[model samples]
Target: MSSTTRILLGLALGAAAGLILAWFDPAHAARAVQFAQPIGRLWLNALQMTVVPLVLALVIIGVSAANDAAASGRTARRALVVFALLLSAGAAFAAIVAPLALSLLPRDPALIDSLRDAIPAQAAPAAVGFADWFTAIIPTNAIAAAAQSAMLPLVVFALFFGFALTRIDATRRERMVEFFQAIADTMIVIVQWVLWAAPLGVFALVLAVCASAGASVLSALGWYIALLCAMYLAVTLLLYPVAVVFGGTRLRRFAAAILPAQVVAASTQSSLASLPAMVESARDRLGQPRAVAALVLPMAVSLFRITSPMQYIGAASFVAWIYGIEVPAAQLAAAAALAVVVSLGSVGLPGQVSFMATTMPVTAAMGLPVAPLGLLLAVDTIPDVFATVGNVSADLTASSVVARAEGSSEPAAPA
Candidate 1:
């Protein structure tokens, strides 16, 4: 069968499986939904398998390659400038969207109880202040941090290694680059082979989410969905487009260039899983410079699940409001700051929501109930589409800005 045919089959089977299980026994439906978990898990594991090696490879390659693209100092400065602008824009966007989502939904006393009941027992402790934030970033041990998959520390370590690789003599650096490139190439091959199963994996992931959620979850949270739609529109239509324009890209061309990454990201509900494709799409189809696409896209996945953080900000504020806690001006500003900082550690992996959960210091500080996290669990997949789209858009925008300013001789593939 053609790829499109296989995708159709997966979608059809997933939908039928979900509905059949729901009709026969809603409780059993959840069991059926479990089928998707392993597929999704395997897919995520494959992506993560390459994280350390790929980051090491790309950053080393990026720094080494930067020397050839332009003056090393200028290239580094320009990339940082683009990255910083994107980060600031993302934080501002979250701050604006949070207040809007809160204003649209009235507080429900019952929701707090229902949400509390739905929460798993091993809930994260409420974060209190700067100390709690500082403690979260400090891993007990470096090896343990890498072993336990602590993202913030892993990034810290990788950046140090990448920078070190750049300081080596050219011949030695080139040899090191060749070795790491082989590893990256091997990982890329594995990533592509696994991607053949992507449509099925995506269907399984989405179907499981729909089947497992209570029938009333959607109906009861109608206003929340409206808020989500508003958030999506603002991000998709306004914030991302403005970023693209500011970065010297035309709207129509930018959309065309980024659509594939958006589609894969939307369907997979993961920016990390979507990374290999995003890299290829941006390089081959979007005509982004190789160094720009390779460097910015991966970094963007780690730093930008744009819509998810926005959702969390909304949830944080709503939880505070419903529980009769006034989020002080200082606290709100702090949350805004933390949201941006925490995003640097957000890999586009399955536990991303959990990472956002960890980022909620302001909510915890204000004595807000974390129960509203349950409400977010229901709609996570839905809003992921927008988040992933924003992620890809930011990468492309950064790529364009960097390319233009650097006058990198590479032209992205024609849209």
Candidate 2:
């Protein structure tokens, strides 16, 4: 079976075991939760340890890549600017939509009990006023921030470091990029190694949760899948209008051109893998100039993922809902900006890796607990289909926008 299936099977079998134990003997169910909690915690720690360094490296690389594009020419610069604005808009959009969507769903008290029961209790976080948050944006000490795991400030340092690399001599800049690239590649391998143990980790985690609250966790999880799928589909449909209005492309023709690429994206769940289909659609169906399509599509795949912000913000919002935290507008705004930055930095990551790597920071930024994320990751395979589709749709739309910006005069192909 595939890795996703293995982890999901682990989730299923765990729920079954936990439910049976809970049904047969409440005493034993409590014991099972106690037994499984430590193992699951260890796995979560393993996933989190990689986040700091991986994000540092990724932010540097992502920023430097965009800077390089900005230097290439006017067209490339415009595309980069457009990509940044679009990513920010998606992040802000999710901040609003996810909370509203969760409000409409039934809140399960047992689900909260299950999460709180599965993990050990901690001291509540102190409230930080707006002044405190604004001051924390630029890290006074980068090393201190990393040690404290202050992701938002540490991310700020990384962003500055990335731009700094662009100003130095070319040879030195090349060396730094190479060095960070090696670190990123090495961390990816480590994360892959950690996830290879995911089935066991998921089993332990879900067993504890289900043992504590039986099947109520299932209801909350169902809400997540449905909500996220709807978010992605909404984003996908949202892009068609963007292509028509901003891109100045015919609506029917744009829709028809992007359909095949969306299909490939849904099946593969990889934008890099879907590149050829996007190029083909852009060149053959949209009638964008070959040069514009070629340049913009690849760049979009690397730097722009419309759903990354949505996923990050959505995961954080779901966690907040589970814990009954009323996320202040201040915190949600911080989370939105954090989501856009981290998502840009970590584009094109594997699903499992991105789920942990990108989502943890936003969760932490919003002051939500990260413990429930392991359970959420197990079910991401379902919504990832729609996430990829949304991404492909955005990629094609971006190409159309860039083509228009470049003043491509090629006559449109038939829908």
Candidate 3:
């Protein structure tokens, strides 16, 4: 069987086993999940271990491989414009649609009380001024930023380093590019090796999560899950039409090209793992120039994250609805803005870890409780598949859009 099939099987069997165990005896299942927690942690750690090195290598190599600073800057500008537009649309969709969908679900007073009880008695986070956020992007120490998994600062530093490399003598620059290319290639190999254990890893991770939460947790959060899935579907369905209309991609062709990558992304719930497939789709299927695909796709893998705004906004809205908190229009706008900024800055973090880091601050900034985030994290695994699929789809679509805009029909000779 294919790896994708195996992953799906693992997810199904794991969730079934966990739910069955939980149904039989919640306490025992929790204990079992606790015992299996290390396996899941190891899998996550293995993936996380590749992130910092992989991102650093990709950014450095991508920038260095560019034709020149002008070309790179133009590409960056176009890609960011596309990313920002799509992200804003997604955020608006989530901010409006999610709350409406959530409102339709019958409220569970018991679940509400449970979530309320879970809230920690802590003060709301201090307001983060615009100046604070701007300064935080340029880290004083790159090492410290990487150590703390501060991906935005790390990315900024990599961009600067990569740009500086472009200004040096050709021979020296080529040597440096070759060095980072080797590192990037090495990390890709490591990722493949790590993913060899994906089925087991996914099984253990889902089993642990399900066993800890039990079937009741699933039932209680069913509506929230439904809302999230709906939002993902809505965004994904909208993406293709946009790609077809504006990007000039054929719908049938786009689907056929992107399906393999989407399958990998859905199964693995990791966009990074699907990067190779996305690049292939962009270059061979969508007819993007090699230079454009190489530059846009790798950077998208680290930075674009098209589904982030929707997911984060939906989560925040759901939390507010559940807690009976009244979020005004102004606060919602602020939350959307914050989510966009955080999503862009969330490069290189593991999937769930990235969600939490980006979402918690929004929750805090909105004056909502962060306690229910644990529960959200528990159930986020299933919806995360859809989210990853959305992200991968957007990545390819954006590449196609940027490539077309650059008027590059044929593959550019490699730098």
Candidate 4:
């Protein structure tokens, strides 16, 4: 079976087992949870250890790639800016909307407590006032921030460090890129290794959580999935307005042209696989020149994935809700920034890898516990499809915007 399938099967089996214990024998449920928690913790730790380095490495590599793309021409530079703005807006939207959505859900204080009791959660760090928090964003020392798991500051530092790499000699930059790429690859290997045990880990975790938290746990997750679906759909639909107003494409024609690419994205669950269709839609249906489509579409596929930031903010907000922590506006804004940075850095990773690698930084930036992430990841299969659809649609939307900006500056056909 596919790894996702196996992990989900494990989740189902564990939840079933736990529910039986909760209903039938409390004493056995207690023992079973004590036995299982450590195994799950170990798996989570393995995954957690990789996050900092992997993010740093990927951010550096992504910066290098984006630098190369921007150097290609004015069109590439404009497109990158558009990608950043749209991603930031989507993330900011999620940051506000997800918490609002979570608040409207039925709150069972007892259920929340039981879920917390299911696995011991780390206490959130003491809050700092705005002055301290704002200054900390620059990180007085990067290594110390990372060692302390001060993700927001460290991520900020990494962004600066990545940009600095661009000013060095080209040969030196190439070497540094190779080095960080190796780090990223190594981290991916470790992630894959850890995930191989995901079935067992998910089983242990779900069993313990379901036993204490009761079947009400599923209701919360159901709500989260539903929220994510609605958010992704909303983002996808919003792109239509963006393309029309900024890209200057007709609404009906843009809709018709993008349909084929959106179908390909939905079916394949891959923007890369949908590229040819997106190019065709851009050139033939939208009347974008072949040259414009060729440049913008490919670059969008490589270095941009709009939904990545949205998912990060959404996950962080959901976790904040589960723990009953009220994230301050400054912290939520910081989480939004972290979400955008990580999305840009880790843009093109596989859904599973990106979920783990990118989302954790945003959650950590918000000072939320990471314990619940594995269960959430197990259930991500449903939302990931829509995330891909939104991403591809955003890609086409971005290309149209770039084409509008570049109007009549180039030939109608590829040189």
Whole-model alpha-carbon lDDT for candidate 4: 0.87
Q: What Cα-based lDDT does every candidate model obtain?
A: 0.56, 0.87, 0.71, 0.87
Off by over 4 Å in 2: 121-127
| lDDT (10s digit) by residue, model 3, range 1-415 | 8555666676667678887887898777867677666776676567567667666676676555433433668887788778778888888878788778777777766545543432322343355566666687688999997786555567678888988987899899899888887886676677667666767776776576566544444564677778888788778888898889878888998888889899999888888899998887788777788888898888788677777888788888887877666666655666776667667645555555555556665665466765455446546666877888999998988888888899876642242
Q: What TM-score should be assigned to candidate 4?
A: 0.97
TM-score of each: 0.54, 0.96, 0.62, 0.97
**Residue-by-residue lDDT tens digits, candidate 4, 146-258:** 89888888888888988999999999989999999999999998998999999999999899899988888778788889889999999999999999999998898788889
Candidate 1 accuracy as TM-score: 0.54
The parts of candidate 4 lying over 4 Å away from their true place are 125-128, 409-415
TM-score leader: 4
Candidate 3 has which clashing residue pairs, if any?
none
| lDDT tens digits by residue: candidate 2, 135-155 | 989998999999877888988
Q: lDDT (0-100) at residue 102 of candidate 1? A: 68
TM-score of 3: 0.62
What's the CA error at residue 393 for candidate 1, in Å? Answer: 1.8
Reference-based lDDT, residue 371, model 2 = 80
- The per-residue C-alpha lDDT of model 3 at residue 208 equals 66
